[model samples]
Target: MNQPHQPSRRILLKSAAATTAALAVGTAAAPALAAPGDTATAAAAPGGFPDYRYVKTLLKPSQLTYNPTGEIIFPCIRGTAGRLSAPLGRYYLYYAPHDAPGGICLAYGDHIEGPFTEYPRNPLVANVWQPHYSVSHVSSPHVMWNESAKEMWLYFHGENTTTRLARSKDGITFTYDKVVLSTSMLPAGTTETSYARVFPYELPSKNAHFVMLFMLNNTTNHRDIHWGWSADGRNWTFDQKALVSHNDVSAVNIGGPHLLTRGGSAFVVYNKDKTSGGDLMITEVGADFTLRRHLGRFYESAAGAPDNGRSASPSFGTEGGVPYMVYESGERLQGSISVARG
Candidate 1:
């Protein structure tokens, strides 16, 4: 089912000067300034506000049995399926489907609201990692579960100004690890640096365990939100300014960043894109990321439903305690991969 085309962010604006001179030869180092104090205690588990209004459509693209060019989007969930010396399912649902053979897929469910099951040898991670390089398509996927490397890291993107890293002890075979973030590590008119999301916070004096939130895309194409800091999630360092912009949400740009801690307080739950529609916003992430504060509308686009107005790349989770999200509902390469709960 590969006919509908054009959308890999316009094939990363026609190869962005052919991968910007090999992406400035491994650039990623220049983010040192995390010493202001008081702010580092968000182990994520208070989950107070979540009124995602009971939406549905859990996975579509005609319920893929293995479909590409179908437009499923970035929705990362994991409560298990790592640390696996045996089991392959208890929950784990990373997704993809951007276009042009776009991949990095997987699905399995015991329940996180799912009848999910798709991994009949699915893309797993494609666009050729052959002798160690190849691109044209690979979409946004973000998985995490590295309790000191028991394993499963997997952030993704391909040629949309790069972001990569892979590793897995289980959670289905991956190993490519490197090129942790690109667009020459951001800023100089940036130009597309994929949608990422990684968390395990602890920074202010540094020895940073890990923290990343992405989506850049400048040179006038707008789009904001940026950050990086990793002691060892596979070497990363980037902060060339912008932890959320479009002047901090007057909105025409802002992107799909999700790092919602709630109750230990640390937020950056994004997606604002507005000519008049797209919502899901919230800010308040202080200390060292340099304090931002734009808390407004955490979900909006219900009127006609099916998110035709836009609700983008989100991915929050909680189960026995309830809260849930997992978004990207419609428009933007024509979407679907929904779920809301509170």
Candidate 2:
């Protein structure tokens, strides 16, 4: 958000299958340079669902509520690269703020359109080295309400080298449950790990399942966003490994995936950093959970960020019976909670 100062650091597992659960504070990876002159257009299809209009800015430097913790926004997620997970009556928006150096916190929002509340004992998470995980930046959140499991599942890519998970009955105030799937959880042939995302594909399921898709950073510019499946949302088994790749050469840092279903087909939305800014790209997934078509670019960031992911989709059942997106915007303005609707 601030003039991207480099982290002197870059970390990921030996392979992409290894992952870590992020939502802590202070931890970060060395900012990589944007792939030059990329992202003029989407390579696959395009993210063309509906036009996303700005709803409101939730947290910002000038508008933040000050509390005793430090600065009012002091206890926010540093990465702001987060997502919105709404069940029915409850809404939880995760924030990645740099509470301090090398720390990341999981901030929460009750209402999608909000004067969102920052969790009281924020920085609800941190990355501690475990044999199962590799230490690194624990940020970039994607949350979901697992109806079948009757539990709230939080997923994010952290320093551990892959996207990891922890479960909670209540969305906020979570307990570190366990990593959903990693090299350890896989059968074989998939051990490479790194920080990535795994969001639920919003298709009404009879199979009692969930789908997670996040970037599998195999290389600096050669990362791929892959998918996985789960029966209980606790233990996930691998599905299609590589879902999308850099078919988009005009863009870079292009992976914060959001999946929503319409007409029995699921639409996947992601972002492409065009250096000038970021644009939301969309694709479709069939009932079988295989990649379908790239719709078009849905929305574009004003200042445009190549670092963070702008990956939020529309919830038709949200208040007002309209649709809205809880995504990170104002990245050029130090990032904050923002809502977008068609």
Counting clashing residue pairs in each candidate, in order, gives 0, 45
- Tens digits of per-residue lDDT for model 1, 17-45: 43343232211111111123422221111
Best-fitting candidate, measured by lDDT?
A: 1
lDDT of each: 0.70, 0.46
**TM accuracy, model 1:** 0.32
Task: Give per-model TM-scores.
Answer: 0.32, 0.64
Residue-wise C-alpha lDDT for candidate 2, range 136-165, written one tens digit per residue: 445555555554565556665555355567
Model 2, CA-based lDDT: 0.46
- Candidate 1, which segments miss by more than 4 Å at Cα? 1-59, 66-120, 123-141, 144-152, 155-166, 169-196, 199-204, 212-267, 271-278, 284-292, 295-306, 314-327, 330-342
Q: Please tell me which predicted candidate would have the highest TM-score against the true structure.
A: 2
Give residue 234's lDDT in candidate 1 (0 to 100).
Answer: 80
